[model samples]
Target: MDVVVIETRPLGDRSYLVHDGEVALVIDPQRDTDRVEAAAAEADVRITHVAETHLHNDYLTGGLILARAHGAEYLVSANDDVAFDRTPMADGGTVQVGRLTVKAVATPGHTHHHLSYVVSDGEDQAVFSGGSLLYGSVGRTDLVSDEDTEDLTRAQYSSVRRLAAEAQPDAALYPTHGFGSFCSSGPASSARSSTVAEQQESNHAFTDADEDHFVRELINNLTAYPSYYAHMAPANRQGPGPADLTVPESVDPAELSRRLADGEWVVDLRHRVAFASRHLQGSVSFEYGRGSSFTAYLGWVLPWNQKMTLVGSEEDIEKAIRDLSRIGIDSPDAALGTDPSALAPGTAVVHYPRVGWAEMLHGRSAGDVVLDVRRTDEYDAGHVAGAVNVPLHELLGRMAEVPAGTVWVHCATGYRSGVAASLLQRAGRQVVHVDAKYGPS
Candidate 1:
């Protein structure tokens, strides 16, 4: 038997193709199905099965697409309440493909229906432990409800313990999600496989810590999940197609400006710090960090009719667009160039100047609304007097909460403030971005 692991970068997702002679199986396919299909063709093996661990809240799965195209059996955890035409695999059930045995393990912590699979070539076993167990940590419970969350975490603990006790120490382990993945609660590792014994000794979620400690740590480490998660579940339930996964072409700054003026949303895909420092006025700073949650967040914040433009390095344009598309926000004309000076008309360029205490006081007296777009934690650690707290990440979604009309935006250095300014300006508000590239001290 041969197993191949495919890494989907940026999203930090992984899919696998396991083959035994002329038979093949695919696990947790990403949005792009062409590559998986091509690989199967090259191997001259018939795709016998396409399996999903659970209903993902991140990217749309390609399991149905691959199944329909190849006449492969579509398998999912039996506990998934969402209706789909496929063979639901129960816990401990095994499916045979030539000499390979794919055993389903019910491990429901990340979601109520989540499952992990163990594969064997009649002898040695390799577990495709989906979201249940990752490199350093386990899947998060907040992906579902509080009860489900605790239940899944507890189940995950048992699942890992069982694998440690039953599976061989040298049995290869493969997971669906990794580092930079929103589904994972801990940092991902570069090392592909670790023995059951090694995980028993080293994996934090599996060793030394009690259940209560593990649950507390898991909940605390989970960052804000994207708002788009509310939409993803239903879309996956409906079994949507993967045809609309295309990136937007780069647009001139001037054209981008016109779109913003016409009520289009300008999304600056820079880091929060980069956006606050200097950016076009009225542009919302929706920084894309690791994982599928970014797409979910965009869906929650951005409307369908809103024309969108991306402000980032040229390399980031394609990725930004792809991330947006996963949640059904297909704004092909939203991409903008990276140069700050070339920003389209109506774009508010951020400027942060270093000045003395007296100069800072004078500027505030001159009537600039001292806009503070950092998180609550950053805001409490001493900020400009009279500045209002509006985190850059939540600015786009909470537009009504921001004071209308004209304002001066600033963050610690002005990176995120720039992004905030661009987003606000595109939203049809007037803004003057303060260039705080240098500290007041």
Candidate 2:
């Protein structure tokens, strides 16, 4: 048996393609089925089974459509209250795929009905741990509900132990979350691969035997997750269809201006520096390129189901469409170009000055406000002295609270700051983007 990883880096998750020469089983697939199809085609294996670890709270699952298209069985936990038909996989149940055997192990905690699949070829075995046993940590327990957090945290501790006890000592460990994913409770091991034995030696869940201490530590360390996660489980439960990757209708300068005038979202997908130099007056900066958390941040900042327009090069716009579709944002109108004058003729194009922490510190004015747009937890850890804290996620609703001044906005690595600066500029604040990594200067 061979296990292939399908990485979705923007969401910091992975889906797997497990095959036994002729047949394949896909676990925790994202909404885009083409990626999975391409992988299966390359491997020259027939997809005979598609399994979901749980009702995902990150991205919509492609398991349902992928299964239907290939005439494969769709496997979901029997305990979940989903709307569609599926081959209910109860704990200890087994499914055979050619020479491989898949056994469902009920490992609740990420969700109440979460299951980990242990696949074996009668000799070597691998565990698809889903959200349970991650590299150095596990999935966050607070996503379920505040009322259930304590119970789930305790359950997570037990679940990790249960999976470790049941699986072979050397079983290859694979997880769906924990590669810089918000789903993970804390930082994951950077090692490329891990096994049950290695995790047993290193993973905190295993190293800390006292369940009470483990539960408290995990809950206390839990930080804020993306605002868009609330819609994922509900959408997955309803069995969403394939993503709409069709290129949005191209809009002219007049239409783009009208959308901007109507207060519709006009996202500019340019480099942060380029966007800071010149952009459409009312356009919001959500740079779509390397090193940018384009999809996650955009999905988090934008109101759910809001009709929006994209402004960028054709390549960026195309990729942005695909990225947005993964988070259930589809069919957005687009305007192709970087030139603000060409894209929104005769409108007031704007620019903001960008600086590093040292430059801002050296050139400080008494009236200049240092605004930290990182999360509350990040602000608590350490931040610029006297920097006002308004997490990027909460900034939209609490704009009035930001003290009136020439705002110098910053974040850990300038991504959130770029977005915050653009929003503040659009709102008519005199803003400067501190486009540099945060550190002691």
Best by TM-score: 2
Candidate 1: Cα lDDT at 356: 32
Lowest-sum lDDT 10-residue window in model 1: 351-360
Per-residue lDDT for 250-299 in model 1, tens only? 67767876765566667777765566566665566667765424454456
- lDDT values of the candidates? 0.70, 0.90
Question: Which portions of model 1 show Cα errors greater than 4 Å?
Answer: 42-44, 186-192, 246-258, 267-305, 309-320, 334-389, 397-418, 424-441
How do the residues 225-343 of candidate 2 rate in per-residue lDDT, one tens digit apiece?
88889999999999989888878667987888888888889999989999999988888999888657798898888788988999989999988988888878878989988788898
Q: What does each candidate score in C-alpha RMSD?
A: 5.2, 1.0
After superposing candidate 2, which stretches have Cα over 4 Å from the reference? Answer: none
Q: Name the best candidate (by lDDT).
A: 2
Sequence-dependent TM-score of model 2: 0.98
